[model samples]
Target: MEQDVFRLHYEATQARVEEALREQIGRMGRYADLREAMEYSLMAGGKRIRPVLVLESCRMCGGDPETALPFACAVEMIHTYSLIHDDLPAMDDDELRRGRPTNHMVYGEATAILAGDGLLTAAFQALTQADLTAQQRVDAVACLSLAAGPEGMVGGQAMDMAGEGRSLTRSELEQLQSLKTGALIAAAAELGCIAAGGSPEQREAVRRYAQCLGRAFQVQDDILDVTSTDEELGKPTGSDREKEKNTFVSLLGLERSRELVEELTAQAVAALDGFSSRDFLVWLANTLAQRTK
Candidate 1:
């Protein structure tokens, strides 16, 4: 697998997910203003890595991309909602995201909050309408619910807020991020496996892979917060320091953080060995480790 080939595939997958998101959003609800707010944030794009992981993992496990499309879009919707809420004045209080004004800045705080709620509910609706067995749908809903609910990302956010202005131990920081970041990523891979009707062994391997990749991604982001420009990050740099929150680069030195990234990347790639076709996932893990933004 050439880097060029992987790049092409990655772009194509991102496009596919966005297209599905746009199409599905049109059908989400009839309230024009609400839909406008929802569309604003949902279409404000990023790498679409989460949805891409869902589709690719499904394909890798011998499922049709179409079969995974709705769920992938659902995951993207959930992610976008989280971002909207995370940027509110009560949260990170940032005014910029993805090189544009934050949702609250553009749409007012009330609409921004409703927009996030709308997207969250719409995501669950998409899940209910997905083409899966009754049992599969039940399990998928349950898994994603746990990942997005107070038990996972929300819980981690609570810990983050509580730990603000205080130094967290390395283990405590890892525990927080594992839920805040790693949980949904792990769910993305597991959902793909479920979508494909993959074996239990395959599910475990991909989940392990996603967990490491998610951690590496966050660690690199923490590193970037210190080293990259605001232009590169599309938001304020040194935010971790401003908030006095513990990060990989904060808990561990820059040199030590880089070492951990290397370790995590290796572990992530190793977890994919069981799959016969894993070049993209491998390349993806390594590329994320070295990303500038």
Candidate 2:
């Protein structure tokens, strides 16, 4: 029953984010092909976890979730752009995503790259267009830039690429995942706080929650790669092993990795200790800890 309620909330949030994404894309006028390519991947079905975090965090901070919608859409756009680039032949070389052909596979490589570029730039445009106070907009944009810039997500990707075919210590692997995957997620939570006019303390607490959640998310992904099927994952399973990447499961063994996920989930929920109206966020953390995809 609890799981059903969580799923209902999840689906509702996903629908809201999807609708806003379509509306945001509809605002673009030039480069019809580029728009199509961008939409190809942007509209690809997946859990809109980051945007949901934005909304939920806003609500947790006693703000209207609707006020955060535009920024939420921007976060999703940034995330989708990352996915588009990560699937390029020069990156992970993936041909499928979200159970369909990847952007590059459907639109060709060059266009796909541009599509990613368009999404990334348009994210800031969306931010500018949002109905937000100047301070809120500035804070949100700064949070995103810091997270997505070279020292954050891009840096993490570089580390991941460099670590390929090499042994990495557990800390090294954690750092890599924190930068590559956790950064944007942390940004999502922080942007939510900014959109809500949260104070420094509130933002700091939520950031900690999101950081733990993000790490747990990657740990779950590592576990899924070893345990899930291609059909379930919507991409080839065991690719981590095939690519010779060091993962939590590889380093800690499956049982210990599962334990780590649980511990991280607990830590994430604990970070919400003093906040009220955090039930949804707590459930979200737990659900993500056990996500199958």
Candidate 3:
């Protein structure tokens, strides 16, 4: 398929996921202030890649997107919550995200923290409400819980914090990226498999694909930080340098980083060979490898 066709598919899926997100958020309990803050960041414009991955992975498994919408929204909520907390004064301390003020910058530290907390817990609620079988829901919940828990994303974050202002070896950086970013991406793909009642072999294949794609995603992000403008990125540029962080770009330079992305993209695409209808997933990996933002 042409790039234009893939772009259209991505846009359409993104819109659908956005609507699902709004509906899920609307069902939240009445806590005006907390809800407002939560909505502020949750509704903030993003690529919605995680949710798209969920929907697309389900499609790849011959499952219905409607059946996957709940899990898709849940992953996005978790992602949005992570971004809110990551932008706090104590974290990256950025004042901008998705071309607007950071959640804490606009809503205050307390509300921002609460908003992140709300979204985090809401993710589980969203999972519980997914339209899957009892056993499927149980498996999906367990998968997501492991990915978001202390041993996964949280642990990766802790390592990231510990490595701040210090140069890390390539292996250490890869380990951090695998947990902090790759874990959730892996879960998104895994959730799609679980939601679709995919066979164990299919589940493992997408997991491998997501692992490579997730690392590529982060590598591209690092590329964008230096190469993309704040307008394109919707956030401050050169932040990695400003924070003195060890990113793929910083460690490998532009040329080498691009090579790494290509390598990972190929690996991700190859992992999809176990499936018959994987054009979208393949195109997505290549597109992400070359994305500016």
Query: Model 3 over residues 185-274: C-alpha lDDT tens digits?
Result: 999999998899999999999999999999999999999999999888887899899999999999999999999999999999999997
* Residues 24-83 of candidate 2: C-alpha lDDT, one tens digit per residue: 989873675899998888888788899999999998998888899989998899999999
Each candidate's clash count: 0, 0, 0
Better of 1 and 2 by lDDT: 2
Stretch of 10 with least lDDT, candidate 1: 28-37
Name the lDDT value of residue 269 in candidate 2. Answer: 98
Superior candidate under lDDT, 1 versus 3: 3
Task: List the global CA lDDT of all models.
Answer: 0.90, 0.91, 0.91
How far in Å is the alpha carbon of 223 misplaced in model 2? 0.4
Clashes of 2: 0
- Please provide TM-scores, in order, for all candidate models, with all chains considered together: 0.98, 0.98, 0.98
Tens-digit lDDT string for candidate 1 (186-267): 9998888888888899999999999999999999999999999999889889988988879999888999999999999999
Instruction: List residue ranges in candidate 1 displaced over 4 A.
Output: none
Residue 86 error, candidate 2, Å: 1.0
Model 2 clashing residue pairs (backbone): none
Error of 3 at 283 (Å): 0.6
Clashes of 1: 0
